[model samples]
Target chain A: MQINLALAQIATKLGDVQSNLEKHLDLIEQAKARKADLLVFPELSLTGYVLQDLVATVAHKPTEDDPVFKHLLKASHDLDLVVGFVDEDSRHRFYIASAYLSGGRTLHVHHKVYLPTYGLFDEGRFFAWGDSVRSFDTRFGRVGMLICEDFWHASPPYLLWLDGADIMLFSSASPGRGLNDKEKLESARWVERVTKAYASMFTSFVAHSNRVGYEDGLLFWGGAVAYDPNGELIAQGPYFEEALTVASLDLNQLRRTRARLPLLRDERTNLVQKELDRILSK
Target chain B: MKIDLSINTNLARTILTAFIKSEITRADYSRAVINLSGGLDSALSLALTVEALGAENVLALRLPYRTSSPDSLEHAQLLVDQFKVRSETIDITPMVDPLFERDPQMSKTRKGNLMARARMIVLYDQSEVFKGLAVGTSNKTEILLGYSTQWGDSASAINPIGDLYKTQVRQLSQALGVPQPIIDKAPSADLWEGQTDEGELGFTYAEVDQLLYLLVDERYSPQECVEAGFDAKFVDVVVKRVRRSQFKRMQPPIAKLSNRTVGYDFLYLRDWGT
Candidate 1:
């Protein structure tokens, strides 16, 4: 099977929910024109990153049949949307979450498990850590979702693979850091290395969508990329610019890679479970 | 691997135009105000400002003291005429001299700081009158060396040229069509007569900028910088100055008695959108 995916590496105005909602509608149309089956946007693509208390201003229950997601719900009839938004619970707790929307409904919402608290990130102050991780069935395959910081940990991807994820979608707002000899951004290199390794290791395709444009002094590097099941970079986006990157994912290759490696079939789930239980018990 | 630190002028032009316009318009200000010093740095900023907000919406103010070089005023006029921006000239000698007169034993360093701060006061007051934000012109090399007055020239609503090093500043200035004479002239803060910036610091900007890129941007250690062809003494001095001036780069530290401190926990600027 073949599916088209578009990475929406777009810039968002901070705390402007109304305009951001409109922007999503417009980009969705552009992706639809490209005949994309799925479109993935960066983390906090709706309200933007580093919002501080302004996160509250844009936080809304996307599941409540609110008007915010009305147009997006209407647009999801033809494709699936993995979008990042500030989610507010009925109890008033906030989470930096990615909502998997298909056929005019939210299939699943994955909150960011790892909230980066140190050095340049203060997300712990504004959001509660998500304690759950699981892969959900989609038209393409069983898919797992991870926000920016959660993908940095080795555990989430491994666990997601164990849960039967054939594809991992990473929504990120990673800031550009340092410079290489070619003047390429350091964070861009780091993202590609980690994503490609995870793809080859688990025999799963990884798609990372990072935002671009400046927020105060922080510049989010757009270099969104997609990797094949064999860990080869299939498509690359530009840096420091808004780009709609489209790539084709082949399911036959996904099967072949897993069949050849059999890394998942060789797993000892019981032993790993016992070890994790022991560690958690302490 | 050696990185080419030169900027892509076309991309720089587009990004800076978008940045200035978006940042200013998002803050509900349609106009921009800048201190035009007739130097390469300010000239580049002024050109970008004109492109972003249009020459009509941009204001160029020349704040000169009695000791300021005549070339400074003349070069500033080149930009004002080149862009056809709204212009003003304010003599700052009258404003800062009263304070300097009271302290007959004041050092040149003290007097420079006072003048730097006095100029900021005039620019800010014009900002209120003109209803525009004060755009900054300091370059990254000066910021890294703490070579600027703390609450003076460094104070601005927005800074466009702060990220570019002195080397990149010269490069961008040339791309932006800055006058060749200004770019080639010896850099100075004009704190006193015949005082050049490199002479006062005892180091050339070209030498320091290359060393700084290796040390800070590439994560090279002082020893690595020396190995990369910078003099050991130069690396040591730059490292010490950067470390010594860390306070100037940050907000004042708030004691963490409570669970949330001002600078640490509640770190948002006051003018956040509602």
Candidate 2:
């Protein structure tokens, strides 16, 4: 299946969800005009990253008939949309989540499985960790979702592959932290390298959407990108600017690359699960 | 791992301006106030701030002591008029002299520190009155060498030129159209009547910039820096200064006894989501 994808890079305001919603709407319209099959936004695109105590204030449910969700649901009538949002569940537990809206409805919601809590990250303090890694059906094919730091773990892609995902979508708020834009920064070439490597390893099309703009002192360099199943770069966006990187992905190529490598076919899932259970239980 | 020390001056100017603009506006402030000392760093910072926030939104404070050079005030006034930004010339001699007079044992060094702190007090006080943020002027070389008066000139709401080395500061200052007199003149803290920074520091910024590039940016060891044509003793001296002044670069390290110590665990961004 041939599909046109747009990775929308935007600068989100930290607490002003209503103002950010306006930005998202404008970008969504731009993507639609460009004839993009799917438009993917950065992690927490509705509310900026580094929320600290504002996470609770900005967190909202996708089920609510809020104006932001209403606008997205209206816009999703024509184009497929994948957007990151701070989700507040029925129990009032908050999660860093992405909602996949297709055909005017919320099809799938993926909470972030990993919450980074080290230097320059404090996600674990506010949001609860997700427990599942699964793929859902889409118009293009089966697609899996991963949040920013979740891509750091090798297991999520492998699990998504086992779950039969043809496309892996990543939403990131990665900051450009270092000297050289080419090598040292987190938003540097290393991100592209890892993104491509993951695509080839899983034999799935990978779309990475990162945001740009400075918040407080941290600067996020927008280097949104996507790669083909063959680990070839299909489209890449600029650094430190708001842009939409569009790409064409042929789903049939996933089968061709998987046939070439056959890593997914000869995998030992049961043994791996048993080993993980033993190691984790101890 | 050869690193290019050369920066695209135009791109550097654009990026720094964007950074300053975003940092100030994102924190919900529309204005920036920088202490213009008639030096390369302060002038460059003021130019960038004016570009970022527009001349009307920028405020340049000229805080000078009684012993300060007349040429310094003239240079600062030239920049203020050139930029067409809001400016105020405050004499810090009155606030600092009473404390000095109370103690005859107070040395010039202590008096200098008092003047620097007094300037910061005025900047912060005006920051509240004008509803603007304090932009810093210290360059990377001085920050690394601990050449600044701590909690004095170092205290600012944000700093744009702090990451730029002294050599880069000069290049950028020229690129940003800083006055030639300020750019050409020897750097000085002007604590006393005729004190120059190079005269007291025993080295020039140009030489130290290259040494710091080799030592810090390139990750060259002191021995490697010596081999790369820096004097062995100078390399050792610069390395020791950078090492011992690490505290100046970071927030005071709190002992990790609590579940959430201030700088240890409570190291979260302030003015977030406002």
How does chain A of every candidate compare to the true chain A by TM-score?
A: 0.96, 0.95
RMSD of each: 4.1, 4.7
Query: On residues A70-175, what C-alpha lDDT tens digit does candidate 2 reach at each position?
Result: 8888888889999889998889989999999987888899999999998758788888999898999998888999998888888887788889888999989987
Candidate 1 at B129: error in angstroms?
A: 4.5
- How big is the positional error of residue A158 in model 1, measured in Å on the Cα after superposition? 3.4
Per-model chain B TM-scores are 0.96, 0.96
Give stretches of model 2 more than 4 Å off: A64-75, A88-93, A181-186, A200-203, A252-282, B1-12, B27-29, B74-90, B94-99, B102-104, B121-132, B140-146, B165-186, B198-268
Q: Which residue pairs in candidate 1 collide?
A: none
lDDT of 1 at A136: 94
Q: TM-score for all predictions?
A: 0.83, 0.80
Q: How well is candidate 1 docked (DockQ)?
A: 0.24
* lDDT score for residue A212 of model 2: 84
Candidate 2, residue A261: how far the Cα is off, in Å: 6.9
| Model 1 CA deviation exceeding 4 Å by range | A65-75, A88-93, A179-183, A200-203, A230-238, A255-282, B1-17, B81-86, B97-106, B210-247, B250-265, B269-271
Give the per-residue lDDT digits (tens) of candidate 1, residues B23-98: 7887889998998877888898898899999899999999999989998999899889888998999999999899
